[model samples]
Target: TDTPVWVKGSGAASDYLALHDRPSITELIATKKAAEVAYKSSSLTAKNIDLAEVHDCFTIAELLATEDLGFADKGDGGNFASQERGLRNNGDVTINSSGGLKSKGHPLGATGTGQVVEIFKQLRGDVEKGRQVDDAEVGLTHNVGGSGATCAVHIFGRSPND
Candidate 1:
């Protein structure tokens, strides 16, 4: 607790259990609702985020997250991710610098905690070289479950005022 990362805001939401019951195939309503609350409570928009550790159990999930979280437009996530712009210090926000769930083996129950740890270290500049987001002051972690039936979004800052 010595190296503190402030929780600026947090939100959670849930939706239909089956993907087919959802209105869209490529988007998660739970994620969007959670993000809206988190962003509003933090008094920050997606542009204010320095980095994000989003649920990427699948490559498409990551892209969907980028859109749902407001990091990119509804359909531009693929483009945003492909341009090297999502890399550390390259664009509006660095994404998945920890290699995300796909690379981190999902970790099932511990996935959200793992994301928080990554953000904690990232804010403190304690991560391995080449993976740290330069000057990371505000970060976000998006966790999902039940095949996008539920989602939790949290924003963290270097300081409460950030």
Candidate 2:
């Protein structure tokens, strides 16, 4: 059975510059911190992740997430996404294979739980055939709470019950 480790982070109100106003446009600072804690707690690294469900509220959000989660270097998010490193279910870290919030549709309060559900299914090999990440032993879920002010990151894997 695979155990889980989690972490969370919140940026300060003073850090609330416009989304476009941040010094590091390519960075998601809260995500970075949250991911750091999760990995530290779990004693794993980005390369160990098999798949992930991230808040893709926008295309840009997904891009920044690639870097924030340590799957790619800063400023190389787009490249990471395009170069078969962050693709669906087979890349270094399969990203948003549940079609993301864009195609899967976001249901406000249920979004975070929804992400967990997808990860739960994925780890169980319960996702659709073409979408399943083979040997999805380590799954990560990233839920952002509005405008990056707060965020939660969790690492999961197979459970004894499953």
Candidate 3:
């Protein structure tokens, strides 16, 4: 059995907050909620993930994503992205081995699927050298649109045959 996209998204409560309540920009409640749903649906947690591809419309977006996606603790996203901890292609829980949306030319509507393609290659051991996560059995993709108004989180894993 092949693993298809196990996806989830944020909803109303956070939507209201994003508009008026304005709790905390760093919180990224919308993205965080979607991540929660995705993890639950996949029966996995951030620690269980082997790699991830996240939106990086700006540098700070990556930081928010890492924490919201559960790869790092609250307020630790910056350090998590730093060199000491390694989220590089070869590190534990490798992040953005595909060079992410920024390097991929940020093709707007295509960014989400592009993230999927990277995860597909990584899971199938088909990506080029120096950028494939070693033995990546599970991966995630995080995509958000227009100032955090919409978010999508997806979990992918190896097929039973693979």
Output the number of the lDDT-best candidate: 1
lDDT of 3 at 125: 76
Candidate 1 lDDT score relative to the true structure: 0.91
Ranking by TM-score: 1, 3, 2
Clashes in predicted model 2: 0
Best by TM-score: 1
lDDT by residue (28-63, candidate 2, tens digit) is: 677888888787777778887888898999998998
Q: Mind giving the per-residue lDDT tens digits that candidate 1 earns over 24-73?
A: 98899999999999999999999999899999999999999999999899
Which residue pairs show collisions in model 3?
A: none
68, model 1: CA deviation in Å? Answer: 0.6
Structural RMSD, model 3:
3.6
Give candidates' CA RMSD values in order: 1.4, 4.4, 3.6
All candidates: TM-score:
0.95, 0.81, 0.84
Query: Mind giving the per-residue lDDT tens digits that candidate 3 earns over 80-132?
Result: 88845343444568888888788978998999889989988788878888776
Against the true structure, candidate 1 reaches a TM-score of 0.95
What ranges in model 2 sit over 4 Å off? Answer: 1-23, 84-91, 159-162
Instruction: Tell me how far the alpha carbon of residue 144 in candidate 3 is from the true structure, in angstroms, after superposition.
Output: 0.1
